[model samples]
Target: MAEPARRRPMRADARRNRDRIVAAAQEVFAADGARASLEEIARRAGVGSATLHRHFPTRRSLLDVVFHDRVEALCAKAGEHADRREPGDALVAWLGDLNVYAAASHGLVSSLLRDGPDADLLKRNDDCQAMITAAAGELLDRAQRAGAARPGVRVEDLLALVSALSLAAEQRDDDEGRANRLLDIAVNGVLLPR
Candidate 1:
């Protein structure tokens, strides 16, 4: 029987470069959407293309890492609210964070879903989506149990509502104002009657 391959810790400089590349990719992808340039990301990261490719050989791999990190950050934020805040405030605040995450994506998720058939890529995307939805559902359930949120609202409904509002905000002249207005309406609609 063949032995399993062993993994080694990354050297400090390589770890720094990897972190830099991921951060640069996030910023570039957010600003330029799905068609952002890898070379530009490398430049932004202060690394060579060789270094970037060494860490992420394919564009899809880089995208996956960037999105995975973002999703995990959102999950962490939601978890923090759930742990420390009042139930109603936790749901509302986490939903606000989710809205910001979706808005920052700028429709790149649609592009990602439609652009590839790579099984690994699709699976990663699905996993991230599940994580996000589960986080939101937990917050919602807490709020409902606390008599703050209305009963019977599904996580899918909440996510879809936020997605729509974020998309509309992107298309309008006053994006910040429009998104906040829409978010306020959605949040208010979900709350139990005073």
Candidate 2:
């Protein structure tokens, strides 16, 4: 007789294993950088090294998966902010969140940007940058129209400023406070005379 088909998408045990692996990878990556070992990841996940290899055949695979996930999340947040608020507010909120995300992913981002193969992976999704830039541009236009921002600010310049602030914040022990302050300065500096 033919075997019965599985009712659900992922089996319960398989789901658990996948969740564990992702969680373990997050911790390992945070603590050990991109070079974190699969063996250590499996150990932390309470699975065998073979299982880890089965799930992620290479370190780049795992990093790519996580990085793409983060980028998607950031993009989604930007979309939501743009939809729900004034463009200037949306830009400010998104920029703050982006700073935090960048701080968290600094190591992986550096690795991806510096490594040739990984840089290709990062650049593969140009859509994310386009979305971000579009959102920033809309916000900047709104702020300028309202006379709340400088007339000639460009989204690219704002993005570079945000990135620099994020990197600087990452270096400080009080990163959260510093990031917030830097974001405040960025927003305030863009404002036109009351």
Candidate 3:
């Protein structure tokens, strides 16, 4: 096999520019979500559009890196729950965690789900979804095998539920506990006991 090409190290100023751009992207994404303007990010970072583009070739690419760490940590939290709780309990608890995270990250993930036209852009670019799916699948499989979850449950459906719950809660009143409360209702069901 031929040798792979070696990547050159970024210059000091370039590294600073990249960091500043990321910091600015975080702020802008927080403020405006997936629709945040790249030009605004560059302006906040004290860099030109060309410089920002040089660092991140596309908006999707920038978003991926900007939210990568949070996504990773969320997935990691799944692993933390798997062995600590009963399979069914673990699954429910993890969904609660995911609901909280999803509600908090409404800006970023709102664009990843099937919510609107802009969401399509993230469909192709998302490794974040894949990672979450894998993590959830592990806990889900355990639940099913242990008879904690019904066999018809699916990772995709679970994720979509969390996404939708987040959107609904966000649209409702400003009550911070609404998402978690909604999740409890969904998981426990709405029917009263006979």
Candidate 4:
């Protein structure tokens, strides 16, 4: 039998609407948490609630779209960073970006960590973690090859350290200072002894 025909690409207008909706939802949900209303999202997107429903029938559907978009962006950033900088440097830079993203998204990361029907969301999140781990491992290997980093440092340990540091940074009123301090401590801890 012949294969089924491929669907046509979305029209520019439809694509614009979708992008607008996602942007609005990102802002609304970040500010208002998971209970952010669909009507508010539609208003922010300059679309009707019916239109929002047409695109995303439920809040989870909208969240899935927004969440996937963020993951793809983070993955792409990791690839770009890997290309543009030394592995360790790239990993460090990406960690900073991830912290900023987490801060801006406001509880999105924590919610993903929770178990539920959204457990798959956490699994997808693990893909990003694995990518970061691989990148960090490569960087650590490079630093080790250069005698710049401690020989025994593991990628998982480094990731855990960064996560803890980021959480600590988030708690501080002087977040920028805290983030810098966290990064400094992370870098220092990974450094080889003279």
Model 4, 70-109: lDDT tens digits are 7578667767777898655666677667656656554665
Return whichever of 3 and 4 wins on lDDT: 3
Q: Write the per-residue lDDT of candidate 3 for residues 30-55, one digit (tens) a residue.
A: 66877789999999999999999999
Off by over 4 Å in 3: 1-4, 9-24, 37-54, 109-120, 189-194
Candidate 2 global CA lDDT score: 0.76
The stretch of ten residues in a row with the least summed lDDT in candidate 2 is: 109-118
**Candidate 2 Cα outliers beyond 4 Å, as residue runs:** 1-12, 112-120, 125-127, 138-148, 174-176, 192-194
Which model, 1 or 4, shows the larger lDDT?
1
lDDT of each: 0.87, 0.76, 0.81, 0.72
Model 1 accuracy (lDDT, Cα) = 0.87
Please give the TM-score that candidate 4 achieves against the real structure.
0.76
Pairs of residues clashing in candidate 4: none
lDDT of 2 at 83: 82
Q: Mark the regions of model 1 whose C-alpha exceeds 4 Å error after superposition.
A: 110-124
Each candidate's TM vs. the true structure?
Answer: 0.92, 0.75, 0.69, 0.76
Clashing residue pairs in all predictions, respectively, total 0, 0, 0, 0
For model 4, the local distance difference test gives 0.72
Model 2 collision count: 0
Per-residue lDDT value at 91 in model 2: 69
Best candidate, lDDT: 1
Model 3 vs. true fold: TM: 0.69
